[model samples]
Target: MTADSSLLAQAREWHVLLHSGRATAADRAAASAWRCTSPAHEQAAMDVERLWALLGQLGEQPASEPAAAQVRPLRRRRSLRWAVPLASAALLVLALWLPQGAWMSWNADFATAPGEIRSVELEDGSILTLNGATALDWTISEGRREIRLYRGEADFQVAKDSTRPFFVEAGPARIRVTGTRFDVDYDGQDVVLAVTQGQVQASDAQAQPLLVGASQQVRWSGERLQPLQALDARQQLAWQRGKLVFRAQPLSEVFTELERSQRQRVIFLDQSVRDLKVTGVFAHDDPQAVLRAIESNLPVRLVRLPGLLLVSRS
Candidate 1:
């Protein structure tokens, strides 16, 4: 039987926590109780265990070696009372080393690692600046310059070519421009376009084309495009200079951007804190400092884990 996506995710989380080498007796008990809540939950957990066994057998090193290395520093006390099987911990190690965008990185002609920004000059003289964890493929034919942004954000400085139009396909949004400077941020769910110079035509499958000029921005989602809104292009595109600027955004959204620069996952233990508003100008180079600043200003505390950070109410 196919397991529900939400239940599968929960099962994965439980497996990670149990094998993290920090699982307490209480944690194991809680997991057992969770499994007993529903038969579907138990089946999901069993599926995860089977997946772990396959990964362990296919892994190059012993199943426990990687997990031991990762959690050694965090292991202040031994949890001898609750022992996890070697195969069960293999998935935790894999999760630590591989990101969700691994497939995108493999398929992209140009891709940037976490916390890495890259600039490439096309043969057509256009400049493309990729943000951290970004991936895209480009095709420059005699008649057109096309870019497929698989994930993340990018800034484009299109070279004027009257005979060849520039096109960017990101998720459900389609952008067209002949010669212009613009930034496109695709986070899988939404595509946001910001024009710094010249004009850009933004559209989706079911919406009319919208013309966005310099200092304007538009968002495309769910087969619809939002009306253009005025923005300071310079401030919005400060990420090119290793800076991040946010204006009254939610804490969860801020953390999403921070993850691109920090190369770490952020988990909110208290859901209420996700909606807290955040506004600041932070240097992307020092994500820890940025997190500290947020903690000082907001009513939240940061907990560092093996490969992720947890946020909780102060």
Candidate 2:
């Protein structure tokens, strides 16, 4: 590991020890030495502090469980001495996994990092949950609540608006609602909609109206409105609830969903993997864990590039 990476590892281990309640006298001494090592040490600790701030914002329990700090019992055994270094190396890599996107709440806008869950309350007391890698422009003015989801998915629990309906515009389609909960997902070609609480009337800027009821979904593939069957409330809105449920979904599509929650971008290395069917219920964060689950269920191999994630047939 580089110097920066090494310091980060130490900083993460220190915090883990502090939180785990297993921090011994030796762990405290090591932290003291690390803090005074150099300015880089301070910087790494500050980085960890920043991460914790964003991580604790949405809820007390983080969706991604942090790595534990290394605390080897001071046994006089020599075999475990080698194990200590191995443990440190593993924890160091875990620190680098922290994504910067989770800090979006600290900004004027609201966003989630890869493997983060973000919840924001609007001016009208409604709640909005933004999935990882999702981007949306939200501005409430005069008598209108408008949001433009540029990409990814967002679930909105809209406050009441009679004259000025709560509106979400994704691509060419716009959904108009008044005091309800709904989800909007904008992919490249198709704009998807799912209503959770109240009724939603969706219409393209240049197309006919598509009415969707609670517990229902409708998709517009740029040409016509396709009404989908009624389904469970979790089918489309599960991500906000920290669950990802797939039913015979292709690996390519699963990778797209996983990209939102992973620090590393997962790219399919072969066309066969793209068409491979996958089904599971994975938590919204710690997407790497989801990949391990996939590997256990399917015939695949995962390769780590310098800054990318590649998946292929075994």
Candidate 3:
């Protein structure tokens, strides 16, 4: 396994141990030492801890349940060492196997690496521009042309094919358009649609026939589609022109976009600093240089570690 993946595995182990309420002082000390070895390790541990907390919230028991009149002690209690690993395995499956999109991209017909932009002509002469780290598969059948966006984002300039309707699928949401220009992004949880020209129909498992027109955007989850919101469609498509524009966006969001464009991992240590608003346009050419520009404007310090970048308050 790569060094980053190895560290993540180790961190998950620590998560199960420490959160099981069975860790000794020595074990806690060891975990601290491991985190100090690298920021990547710390970040992985943080992710596991966050997930564990969320699971606890979801598994909360009812407060009004009556106590059993006759209580029988179990012959033996199962060790959490085994139990927590099972739960962690489920979490891993959800991260890799579900709609997060990494696994699906392996079979994509067209893809673009991080920081690389490419445009291709479809069989029907439509132009598709894939953003960095994006993957998709397309098929043109007799009556319909379909594209599945597994990860990242894409801009479509559909050809005038009145006979074959075009459709783009991102997770549980679908976008249907005969001939239009628009953008779609699947960011793990939500499929975001932005229309630049003409009108398109967006639908999900729960909602159908939602219309999106020029200069409007909407977010769709599996069960619900958000109301259309007004936005500058051109500004949202700035990535296609090799630039990233942020308007009062959080530092965490900026870091996420930066990581994707640079194909590098970024670890933010201070949660309090994550929500600071940032606004600017930065080139996607060199991620390190882009970060330096951010540091100059924002009150944050970045530490470059092997295979990862650490963000902390200045």
Q: Estimate each model's TM-score.
A: 0.69, 0.64, 0.65
Encode model 1's per-residue lDDT on 51-72: one tens digit a residue.
5665565443432435546576
Q: Model 3, residue 298: what's the lDDT? A: 80
Q: Clashes in model 3: which pairs? A: none
Question: Looking at candidate 2, what is the lDDT of residue 104?
Answer: 38
* Pairs that clash in candidate 2: 102-113, 115-261
Residue 122 Cα positional deviation in candidate 3, in Å, after optimal superposition = 1.3
Ranking by lDDT: 1, 3, 2
Global lDDT of each candidate: 0.80, 0.70, 0.74
Q: Give the TM-score of candidate 1.
A: 0.69
- Candidate 2 stretches with Cα past 4 Å from truth are 1-108, 222-224
Off by over 4 Å in 3: 1-105, 221-223
> Across residues 1-314, which tens digit of lDDT does each residue of candidate 2 receive?
11354566677778878778898889888888888888888877877665555444422322332335223543334345445444433433343454323333444355655666678898888888877777677888877888877667888888887977788888777788888988887764678888878788888766677778887888878645676658466657778677888888888878878777765556454557788888888777657677888889888998653224657789
* Candidate 2 local distance difference test against the native: 0.70
TM-score of 2: 0.64
Structural RMSD, model 2: 15.3
